[model samples]
Target: MVDNSQGHSAYSEDALLVSRMNVKPGGKQAHMRDGWFMRDGVKVIQQMVYPPDHPEFPNEPKGMKAVLAECGLSQQRLRGKCKKCESDSLACCYKRILELQADFQEQKSLMQEVIESMGHLSIFLLKFTAS
Candidate 1:
């Protein structure tokens, strides 16, 4: 007869492994992702502060003046004072977050594939050794 206790122990170990790999909602992983987004947003804002022609931001998107105009904010108005400008800024940040998240997911998928392959190899070795 198969040992029920051994089966149960194996099942518990698998469960633990899965739980460790899964990211819970509102958990530490979520907080870390949010923090990364905030950091990226800050970087975007800092980049916006420089003009496109400025040596420091040669690739900047037409400068903050153009961005403000695109968002329908007058040059004299503060970004916080204009709802459209704030929304546009948030949209830019959100786009950046989405791009980063996609790259992260791709890397995670690759890592998971590697892990699964290793697990298969281990299982094969165990079976070969047992036989």
Candidate 2:
């Protein structure tokens, strides 16, 4: 049996009486009862969010199994999830900081090289002028 637990308003009789002229044509606006359209004993309820076990869900946490079993609904354990997220964010931030530090070191070295070359040019100009 199709799960109408989400409160779809589809009727069974319309599907069986397909040839009857009075039967509403099947569509979103067709056999609508209780805010849902009927199509072969199935209600046209939106099914965007699949269960956690579904492959489309992606990286379903082990903690989610407990939530589904206990509450019959999917819920995140924010305490643990948030902690892990914060740790990952911190790691990313540290990695970026190290990269920036390396870039800054390279720029500083280039600046030092330019300053030394300018000093040598000044010394050469002074010696030639003195002669």
Candidate 3:
């Protein structure tokens, strides 16, 4: 992993002490988390601003896991079973979600595979003309 510390000194664009910018390592987005070396040092400072879905969600102490669990319980019920009417609508929705996730996973495995199968899936794009 590349050292991406903002550095002890600040300088211009052409400075020699420049750091890496969100480069992926081992084909994965690398988290240059200082937590590995420094315990409890991951706390945010005054000037720095974190974004949504940045692991540390803004203004809410409850983490993403808590948030997602709350949402699933309230919205769809995490067990993928219907809360109201004990209906299979929830199961159907969850099944569709799984199908879409699988499709996306399959597409990400090889870009060419999606291109080869574009003729079948791309039909949705022409929804206006499709009878």
Candidate 4:
């Protein structure tokens, strides 16, 4: 039990569980802290910060250059492909990469803006109150 201005209250397992925000794939990347459950080939729940020193995993390529590199079809490989399907395959892969890049950029920019704006706001508020 702990007390301050407010009266003391009991703490229990339920309280601990309720405060946790589980960040699983369906709930992944939420801008809040959550506890996650782990299971086969997936994390059922994920915490806000990844576990300490977590190893990075492979992510799907999201740019034209990255896709071409992953598919082993860089400029040289494209040249080696049969003429009939050469342009078609390249166009398809390029389109996919552009789509991925668009999505990734949208998400990345939004995250950056949110963090910066919030940090600035916090600083301003602190300075304002201090004066």
Better structure of 1 and 3 per lDDT: 1
- What lDDT score goes with residue 92 in model 4? 39
Question: What 10-residue stretch in candidate 1 is worst by lDDT?
Answer: 28-37
Query: Which clashing pairs does model 1 show?
Result: none
lDDT for each residue of candidate 3 in 1-131, tens digit (9 for 90 to 100):
11223331233332211022111111221222111111255432211123355554342233212322332322344333123323344333332232232222232212233434675332212124346
Candidate number of the best lDDT: 4
Candidate numbers, best TM-score first, in rank order: 4, 3, 1, 2
Model 2: residues >4 Å from true position, as ranges? 1-95, 98-101, 109-113, 119-131
**Residues 18-126, model 1: lDDT tens digits:** 1222111222211111111123344222222234467654433333233334334323423322322333453333222222332223333323445466774212222
Candidate 2 residue 32 C-alpha distance from true site, Å: 62
For model 4, where is the 10-residue window of minimal lDDT? 16-25
| TM match of model 2 to true structure | 0.14
Error of 3 at 72 (Å): 12
TM-score of each: 0.16, 0.14, 0.18, 0.19
